[model samples]
Target: MKSNRFHKQLCAFLVTAACMPQAHADAKKMWVQGSWVNIRQSADMNAKVIDHLSTNTPVFLIAQKDKSCEISWGISGHGYIPCKFLADQVLVFADVATENSSPEKAKNYSPTRAFWIAPSMRGLFNAGKYFQENLLKPEQLNLENGSVQDRPEPQRPPKLIRYSVPEFEAMKEMMNKGVIAPVVAFAPLFSCEQMQEAKRRQVGSSKDEFTRSSNDWSAPDAEKYPYSYIYAHDCLVPEIPKLSLPKIKVSYFKDVQKVLPGNTQIEEISAKFGIVERGSVTGSPRWALDYDTYRYTGAWDIGSYTLTLDKPVYEHVIGRTGLVAVYRWLPGIDEEPFGPSASCEEGLRNQRNGKELLSGYPKVKDALLWFQSATPLSFRTAKINSRAYLAPARSLKEGEEQRGIKKVVVYEVDLDGDGIADFVQWDMWGEPEISGPSPLLTLRQIFININGVWHPFERDSYGECT
Candidate 1:
C-alpha cells in the first residue's frame, strides 16, 4: 500500500503543467519570465548549476521531470529549469515602485508575476495606473486559469474599412456569374522531407498563408514532379495598375562621360538615377518614430543610390551619425573598376561605414541635393521573375473565401547564389480592414548572407519552399 501510494504521488507530480505531451511533440517555444533563472544538471534544486538564463531567453520544452522541465537552450546544450519560470506567451515588464533601493539590489529586482495583455493594448496604457484603475472593474483576469473571468464586451461593432454594399454585392454577383475569372497562379508546395528541411533551416510560413502539416499533405509523386516545386492554381487576381509603383524615369547624368565634371557633390552624384515620381522603393519611406527622420528615393541610372540623413526632427540628439549613403553599381558584376577594385561585399561595407567619401560630400543637410544615374554594366542583368500568388492583401479580413480569392505578385531574385531565390520583392495595395489608415505594403526583403549561409530577416511576410 505504501509503494502504491508513493507511485500515485509520483504520477501526480509528473502530470503537472510541464508534462504536456502535445507541447513536447511540437517543441513549443517558451520564454523565461523570471529575472535570472538557473539551469541545473538535474531536476533537483541543489543540482550542479549548468548555466544562468536571462529573462526573455527562448527555450524549447523537451519534457517534465518532477517540478523541473527539460529544455533545449538554443545550441547551448540541454538542462532542467523550474517549470514555474517559463511562460507560453511573451511577458512584458514595467517599472515597479520601490523604496530605498540601491543599485546593487536593483540589479536583482525581479517582479514576482506578470499579467498578459492583448498586443493592441500595448503602449496605449500606463501599466501601473491602468491596472490600479481596472483592478476591480469588469473583465477581471483569471490568473489561475490564464484567462479573463468577466471580460466586458465592446459597446458597438468594430469599425472596418470595407467595400460599399452595392460594390460588394456586384463583386459577388460577378464571381458567381463567372464574369471575373480565376487566373492561374502558383503557391510553393513542400513534401514531408522538405518540410523537415525547412524547419531545420528556421524558415517560417507566409503572412497571408498558413502552411499545412506534413501529415495532411498527400505523398508527392516523384516521377511526375520534383520533390519541392511551385504548385499552380487558378485564383482570382485583380489587376490594379493604379496601386503599382510608378515606373522609374530614365535620366542620365550628363551622358555618362561629361556628367562627372560638375557633378562631384552627393546631390549631383544621386542625380544619376532619375526621380521616381511618388511611391518609394520600400513602399512608404516615412519611418514612424518618437522623433522625425526622413528618407528620399530616386532612380538608378547606372546603379542604385540611397542617401540617408540621420538627423532628428523634434529635437536633435548630439553625436548622432549623419550623411549615411549607399551607392551600388547597376551592372550587377564585381569585375568593373570604375566603381571599386575591392570585392563587392568589402566595397559595400566601406561605403556604408563612411570610409569612402566622394569629393563633393557635404557638411550639412541644407546643401544636399539628389539625382539618379548609374554606370552601365558589362555583364548581363540579373533575371527577375514575376509570379502571381493567391495570398490576399490586407483589405480582405471578414470573409475567408474572399480572402483566398485575392492575389499578389512576387518578384524574386537569386541573391544567395543557391540557384533558388532567396530574395523576394512584392507590393500589396488596399485600404486596411482595421480602423487606422494602412501604410503602403511594399516589401523588399533579402536573406542576410552570414558566412555564405543565407538567413531570412524576421518579417511578417515570407516566401520560401519547404
Candidate 2:
C-alpha cells in the first residue's frame, strides 16, 4: 500500500514538471515611443525610420525567463528584429514564483542579460554631441598647419611689347588661326669705313636702302630699333657687301743675306742657322723671329729676296743657347697650331688642380660653373601582394579546437588591373601563439597599389620600397 502511494506522488510530480513554463520561453514584451526611431536588425545595417507611432505601429520587447533575454518586434508572419535594438524598452511578465517554489529555490537563478537601442536614436544621440563639439563653433574648426601665414605672394603677369605694322599683321593672322609663331630677323650694324666704302661702290640702287660703313656699327638700341624691320608685299632689301682686307705674308725662313751682308757658302749658311749638316744639304735648322724688326710684306713680294750668309754670322748667331733651347722645345712643323701656346698651358694647369685655379682664371671658372638647371630625374616604385586567412564563425557549444593556418604564401598582386607582377611578401603567421578562451590572433592584412601594382602595406622601415 505504501509503495503504491509513493508511485502515485512521483507520477503527479512528473506531470507538474512537464506542464510548467520553461524559464527561457517566459519573456516580456514592450512598445517604443519617440519623435523618430530607426528600426534595424543590427547596428551596422541601414535602418528604417519610423516618424510616428500609431495604433498599427507595433513595437515590443520580450525578456527570456532564463539567462540572456531575447527581444523582437511585430507579430507572426513579420520579420524579427535583433534583441539589442530595444535595450531601453521595459519588460512585463506574470509572477511564476508561487507555482514552483521548491524547484526554483533548489536551482541556481543567476541570469545573463543584454539590451539594444534603435539604430536611428543611437546615431542621432551620438552624432549630436560630436557635431556640436566639432562643427558648431568656428574656433574649434580652425586648423593650424602654418600654411595660412606662410603662403607665397601672388605673381604679376609679364608685360607684352607693342608690335609694328608688318609684325602686327603676321601676329594677327597667326592668332586668327589659333597658332603660335615667333618672329626673328637680323639687324645689321656697320662701321664708318664700311659705310663710306658702300657709298663709293654705289651698292644700294633704292633710296630707302643703303649700306652703312662697318665702322659706323654701334650697339643695338632697344628704344630706337626695338625690333628688326619686316617687309610686306613685294618689297626687297639690298644685300650687304662683304669688305675685303689686304693680305700680308710673313716668312720664317733664314734671311742669310740680311744676316751676313755678303755672299757665303752653303756650309756657312747652315752653320749660321743651326741647320743639321747632312752630306750636301742641311736637314734641320733653328731660327728666331725678331718681332720688332719684322715688317709687313705683301704676298706678291715674298719670292723676291735672295738669302746669303757669311762664316762669322754662323759662329755668332746660331751658337746662342736661347735659340737652341727654343728650337728644341717648340719645333715648328707642317701642321697648323691649334691655338695660342698660352691656351695649351692653361689646359694643363686645369687638369692638375682645377678647383684651386678657378679663381685665377675667369675662363676656367665659367667653364666649371655648377648651376642647377631644371632637368627631369628618373625614379622607381616597388609593388607587392599578400593573402590573409579569414576568422572562423563563433559557436555556442565547445568541440574540437579549430585548426590554425599552417603557412601563408603571399604572391604579387596586380591590383591596378595591370598584368605585370611587381612584388611579393610571404611567410606570414598569426600572432599570440596559444589559443583558448582568448583569441589566438587578431590578424589584418593591408595592401597599397603603387605604380600599377599592389604592395603589402607595412608600418615600419621595411614598408619603404622605392
Candidate 3:
C-alpha cells in the first residue's frame, strides 16, 4: 500500500515537471513602444506604474488581457504591460542563469544609464578622423619632422562599412516600435552645446532631458566609438532639418572680435543672432554669444529645436539697442507706449517677463555644464529654475482678493516683420507678496508660432532656465 502511494506521488511530480516548459513557451518576447512605457502593477493604464521601460527594451510575455498583457521576467516579476504601447517585435533578455529572472531582474539593468549620446553623421565623420590621426596612425607624413619615416607606412584602415541591410532593418524594426534618437558615442567628456544642438534635431515634444528622447528609439547598441552604433540607428536620418527660427532674415551679423565698439550702432544690433560683449567678473570684456540669443521664443519652439521670429515690426523705440538688451522681447519693446510704465501693473508684468523675473545668463551658462559630463543629457522640455506663477488671465479689480500672481504683460509683436505677428511675450508681472521687495518682471509664458500652432515656454520651464 505504501509503495503504491509513493508511486502515485512520483507520477504527479513527473506531470508537473512536464508542464513547466510549455508554460515558459507561452511567454512571447515583446518590445516597449514609446520612448517610455510605464510598467504598471496591473493591466490598467491608470494603475500605478511599478517602473518605466525605455524604447527598445525587451520583455517576456506571460499572458494577454484586454487592454494589457502580463509580462514576466521570472516568477515574482510579473506585471501588466499596456497593449497600446507594445510593439510586435519579440526582443529577449539573455539571462545567464538559464532560469528566467523575475521582473525585479529588470532593475539590474538600466538601458538609459549611458543612453545620452552625441554622435552626428558629421560628428561620426569627425570621430573617424580623430581615430585615424590619434590611434591608427600616431605618426603622420610630416615633411618637417620625418615622423612618417618612423614606421612602415601605416596601412590605411578600410573605410567604415555602410550600415548593412540587416542593421537598417534592425533600425526600422526598432523605430516601428518607439521614438528613434541620435545615438551618441560615449566620450570621456561630452559637449553640452553639441547635445543641445542634437536635441533640437531629435524627434520629440518635451524639452526636458531624457524626457526629450522619451519618444526616441532607445539605442541598445551603445558600444565603443566607430562600432556598429555609428550610423546604425536614427543618427543619420537626413530628414532632420537644421533647427532655425523664422525671423524673416533681416540681416546676419559678423562675429564681433572685441567688446562691441562703444558706438551703440543700429546695424550691429539688427541681426537675429550676433556675438556680444560679456565682461568677466573682474570687469574685463570678453566676446560671447548674444546674451539674449534665445530670449524671444514662439509657440513653434517644439521638437529638438526652438526656431525664432526676431523680426518684430517696431511701432516706437523699435530700434532701441538698450531696450532689446533689457527685455529680450519686443512687447517689452513698446513697454511704455505699447503697454504701461514700471509703476503701473502693466509695467510689472513686462518686467517679470523681461530679465527681471527670468535672467537668461545663469540658465544658458549652467546648461553647458550638463553636456560636459560623461553622460550629457538633452531635453525637449526642461526646467530653467526661474520662478514663475502661471495662472489664467484676470484683472486686478478694486476690493478683490489678490492672488499670488499679479499684473502681467501679454502682447504680440511681429518679431520677423512678416506682417503677421509670430511671437508673444505674455504674463510678465510682479507679485510683491512672493517676489519679495523687488517687483518681479516675468511673463506668464512666452509663445512662438511654429507653422500655425503657438508653443509656449516659461522661465524655469526648459533646461536650466534660471
The models' CA-based lDDT, in order, is 0.32, 0.24, 0.31
Report the lDDT tens digits of candidate 2 across residue range 1-466. Answer: 3333222222211235432223323454433322123333333334442221211123334433222223433222122343333434432111110122246532421110000111111111222222323332353223210122212443232221111232112212222222111011112222223333444444444454343222232232211221222111111112212211112122211122223211223333333333322221112111111222211111111111122211112111111111110001111112111111212221011111112221121222212101010111111111233354333433435674544332343444322233444222233333334323433322222222233323223211111111
Candidate 3 displacement at residue 58 in angstroms: 14
**lDDT, candidate 1, 340-403, per-residue tens:** 2222221011011122323343232321111122431221123345665544335445653232
Better of 1 and 3 by lDDT: 1
Highest TM-score model number: 3
- Worst 10 contiguous positions by lDDT, candidate 2: 110-119
TM-score of each: 0.21, 0.12, 0.23
- Model 1 has a clash total of 16
Candidate 2 regions off by >4 Å? Answer: 1-27, 31-58, 62-466
User: How big is the positional error of residue 113 in model 3, measured in Å on the Cα after superposition?
Assistant: 7.1
